[model samples]
Target: MTDHTINKAVLRRLLSYALDDPKKLGYAILLLLVASLADVSGPWLIQHFIDHYIARDQYPLDMVAGLALAYVALMLTAAWFRYKQSLQFNQIAISVVQRVRKQLFERMINQPLSAFDYMPTGKLVSRITNDTESIKDFYVFVIGTVLKNVVLIAVMLVVMCLLSPRLAAVVAVLLPVVMAIMVIYQRKSADAYRTMRDLLADINASMSESIQGMSLIQLMRQEQAFSQQFSVLTRRHLASQIGVMKLNGLLLRPLIDFLSGVALLSLVALFGVSGTELIGVGVLYAFISYLGRVTEPLIELTQQLSLLQQAMVASERIFGFIDARQQAYGDDTRPLASGQLACRNVSFSYDGQQSVLDGIDVELPHRGFLALVGHTGSGKSTLASLMMGFYPLTEGELTLDGRPLASLAQSVLREGIAMVQQDPHVLSDTVRENVRLGRAVSDDDIWQALEKVGLAGQIRLYDAGLDTRLGSGEANLSAGQKQLLALARVLVARPKILILDEATANIDSGTEHQIQQALQILRQDMSIVVIAHRLSTIIEADEILVLSRGQIIERGNHPQLLTQQGHYWQMYQLQQAGEHLHKLEESAGVPEAS
Candidate 1:
């Protein structure tokens, strides 16, 4: 929504963040009011000195000195209050922003996996950091400065009306025109600010994407292409910012100055035509001073209005993200009895156009091992994700231990099941921490888990063993090492059920052998579902499902599937042929042409 139609609920919520610490806010308000009063007293004191002391020729040395001293004291008092007001206002604003950022981060992390599929990580980061920072300006500058200016304007108007009602009427007439300008500015700037925010998000997304794929870009020799793409986004962002700057420059201070000049000229003409008796010198001087003070606040308010508009746009985006419906699961605290998983006539579609998995029926008893073999786009990974509670089923039902999976609590599902992906992320932490994953696990358990994955000996060779620090993407480890590390992580969890989605696809034969051995130990007690592209790995599975275009074309043990001479048999024969060709070339000592 635009700033003009700022949702009351959102504004109220934003205000509530500041009001959370009412004492600090109250102290800031009090200081602001005192500072404004002190500011207003300046014109009154000047008028008093002009009318009673200077104009009346009653300048006594001691009296003049005391008046000057009192004026200086008032100025110093105003400065002190203004300084304290700034500190308190900043404190309140910063606190509110901190709370908002924390809540946004918490909400983001708790979001379902599906949300990350569409939302850009960089854009999310921008909303948490940049957008919230804009809201900080709303609290620190807009709210505090606007309130103080309003008070100052009110006091000045009251004194102006008392001094000369006619001049006050002129100001009143011009006030609406100034407000009209502010309204126009707000409307025009709102769109500009929103554009700027969107462009910034785009830039962040582009930069993050580039950084993440830097290695790929370099490998492909496409650095220049990526640079151009990033440059385009940055240029667009810069252009958006320039548009906002131009709008602010034309509308904010310049318009206020023009309006102030008009008011001053009007005052001069009124006084010129009228005599001293009608508008005294002291009154004229005070009116001129009050007019300047009035316009200063108007200028500040106009500038803050721009910031407020930006903040409103940011709040809308943030609130939109916060308002997304989280995935629904039961709050049942009961532990899962067994990991027996079953899917009955489960049909699924990502976009509701074409089905990815159709009329699928499968069951795995506790401690059983089922392997899903499929070509790419055969819905093998999708089925595994469904089993992990990553997405809601589109049709039919998936269950665990005779209970509907959807009805099970997320914690229960997590406790009972774990999945190791094809390309698992290795956290930038010590090996122990990575495996423990913040759980209260002992070093012995960590070592045992590593040993199970055949990584203990390799880890022990490092200077710090399990305590060695790993870089992001596990730069210190090979693809097989990272995969083994991920396996170690799951082993430590000791899940009742495990799904490995091509977990050994990239590992060497030796590392694959190590993983297969670990799986043998795991399958003794836990139900294992393995999604594999490699046919050799699943030869020993109790049952293997050959998925073709989302349907199971063949379901049997390796020998049974081979006897059928179906899709599974053809795939196995082709893979064996490809391996034999590679071995023949290696034995002949021939370097195959790229």
Candidate 2:
């Protein structure tokens, strides 16, 4: 769509948010009109006092002082209106901004996992915090400054026309000039503001990446390299900001003020030429005062144009996020009760043309243990993702029990299947909370699952037991312990199907043995599908599929695959040799007793 169309759509959305609380908005509008009317009446009171009393040489102190007191009363009323209207406008802006933030947050979480493969978390965070803040500023400026100033201008113009048509005409010249400046400023600065926001997100992204990888950067001594890269992003961001600053500096308040000066000069020159016969001295005073007051709105408006551009750009990003397509799901809400899985002629691709997994078929046994072992990019992880409905299959019939896997509701799918990755994210929360993960699992169940994973004894030694918050290094669970905690989490979840994607790849032998024992017990009640790099981890699987180049090259139980002396047999032999060599190195490195 064209930028104009997009801007209109964003404005309409913002207006809707603003209008959500119509009662308050209406009250604010009423008060703005009251404030504007009262403020504009002051000039007329002065004009009356000068023209009717002072100019006529009939100075009655009672009447003049009465007019003065009335002017004060009007000013006081206007001040009160200003306060109430500003409060109402502020409340409305805050509500709209709050709604916008919440909607943006919902949009971020509603996206499918696949959407996040290309989306950066840092940019998303920038949208939620920085961009939303820009939107808030825009709302406040538009309502409190621009809107009220506009009402004041309208009242002033109407009063000016009543007093002197020619002076009002002189002031009208500034409106078109102000409008032109606004149009040009918006046109020139939209892209600059958008680019600035993008660069800010990039800076945030770079900083987030550096923070997450700080240890890796220090270990590799790439601190200087990372610093250089970060400096480049920040410099680009700074340049973008300076460009926006220049645009605002050039096209905003100063230019508008210059135009206002020209308008005021034209008004004064017109009054000078007309003289006392055509323009009364009192009329001249009111016109000059109104011109001065009018400049405030014009300058205020031009200043707000910059914020308008920013809000338009930021809102476009926010709406784009809110409008992105949601992940497809189906109407099946009945919870999946069985672990039986069937895959027939399954095929997949990331970019449509290149197949990642092709013509795969599987019939998992009831309460079975199935293993998929392959080298990198051999589609093991892809198949595991499919098992959990993480991606749509290119061509396949994948079923959980008797129902199509894709036809199940998200709740049904999540409740029925559990996936454990190699690196499980451990929350810096209590062990009980981490294990339960907001599930309704009890403390007793948490301890039981911990015991099954061989972590119960260690946890029991802690003063607070399950309530103890996990931490780093010697203060908390190591990587393997975290992996075990994740397993315990799964046990409490009680999913019908458990998919392990190298869940034990990094742990030591003793922990691996403990996990194997846990899996053996879990296999009785849950169907387990494992993708293992270590062939030894899944030697006793009911079936093993050795995948190569997006296709299964060999399939059987470990002993049967060994007898075949095929791809699976060769992989096992290689792993055995590597293990034997590592053991020899360890023995050779042992020091003699001295």
Candidate 3:
């Protein structure tokens, strides 16, 4: 879009946020009008004292004293009105910002999982935090400043015209020129502001990456390289700031001062030539006072315009994210009566070009354990994500108990299905809270879930037991303990279908055995799907599917697949050999190398 069109669109949207609470906006406007009226009266009052009391010298001392007292009262009243106006404006601005920030946060969280793949976490954070903060300035300062300035200028112009039409015409002529300068500054600074914002996001992203991977960077001795990269981004950001500074210096205060000087000199020359009959001393003084008042706000208005431009750029980025079409959640709310799941002719792709899963068909009976054994790129995890409704299929029919899975509401789908990943996040909270996941579950339910996962005994050793706070990174727990805790989290929900996606891939054999025992208990009631790299864990599965390059190359129970001597057989044989070698080493008293 053209700069003007984009700015206008963003400005309109920003104003709409304020319009949400029209009563507050209306009150703010009323106070502004009152303030402007009081402001305009100040100069007129000065003119009245000069013309009627000082120059005429015809009024009594008491009358002049009364007028002076009235002026003081008028000034105090105007100050009160101005104070109320600012207070009202601030309240409205804060309300708008709170609403926008809340909506932006909600939209970010509700986006599809796929959306996060291409957008960096740090950049998304910048939009929600930094960008939103910039927009806050637009509401709190820019909106109020612009409105107040316009009112002041309009009031001054009317008073000026009444005093001298010729002088008012001069100001009217210069007004457009000053505004044109502001418009030019806005257009020129747009790209610079956008670049600054982008550079800030890059810096934030880099910092987040470096912190998250600090150990990796240290191991690889790449600290200096990352530091240099960060420095370059900051330098670019600094350059953009300098560009904005130059624009502000040139167009804002200096330009307004020059125009104000020209107006004053022009007024002098007009009165000097036209004589006292055309324009009196008091009238000239009042015009000069009005001129200073009018041009001063125009100067501030220019600066506010700069802020408005930055806010518009931020608004564009924020709105762009909020406008992204999220994954659709259908209206179907039918309860899952059974754990039976089936997929027929299912095909999918991440980028819509290459196939990730092709013509796949699978079925799991109620309370059955179905395992998916596959190579690294064999689409096992992709299938699990599809089954969980994380993405829509390119071509397929997936069903839960004969109901189309794609037609189910997200809440319904989540209620019936749960997946445990290889790497699960643990929050920095009490063990009980982590398991309950903010649900209002009873202490008995949390303890039962932990007991089912075989973690209750370990937890009981701690002084605080279930209430013990887990350290950041779950440092208090072992890898196996974290996996079991994650399982406990899912168990608390009591989903009808459970998917264990390589959950034991990183744990020890003993821990795997414990998880297997837990799974044995769970499988008696829920349909289970396990995607495993270690073939030994799934040997007892009712059915096994071997996948290669997004297609199932073999399908049968573990014993039947071994009889075929296919891909599953080869994987099982390799794992068996590795285990045998390890057992031989232990029996021979060989110390395992770290």
Q: Please give, for residues 437-534, the per-residue lDDT of candidate 2 as tens digits.
A: 89898888998999888899989898888888886432477788888888898999889999999988878899899889988888888899999999
How far is each candidate from the true structure, as Cα RMSD in Å?
A: 2.0, 2.5, 1.9
Question: Model 2, which residues run further than 4 Å from truth?
Answer: 1-6, 57-59, 471-475, 584-594
Expressed as tens digits, the lDDT of each residue in 24-114 for candidate 1 is: 8898989988998888888888888888888889989988898788888889989999999999999888888988888888888777888
**How much is 332 displaced in model 1, in angstroms?**
2.1
Q: What TM-scores do the predictions have?
A: 0.96, 0.94, 0.96
Model 3, 1-594: lDDT tens per residue? Answer: 255534677778888988878988888888888888887888888887887777877879888788778778778877888799899888876777788789888888888888987887788889978888888788778988888889989999999999889878877777988988887877787777778888998888888889989999999999999999999999999998998898899888888899889988998998899886787788888989988898888888888876777788888888988888777887899878789999999999999999999999999988999999888999999999999989888998999867888788888899899999988888899998888888888889889988887789999998888888896543388777888889999998888899999888878877778778888888877899999998888988999999889999999998899999988888888999999999999999999999
| Residues forming the 10-long window of minimal summed lDDT in candidate 3 | 1-10
For candidate 1, the per-residue lDDT at 522 reads 88
- Please give the range of 10 consecutive residues that has the lowest summed lDDT in model 1: 2-11
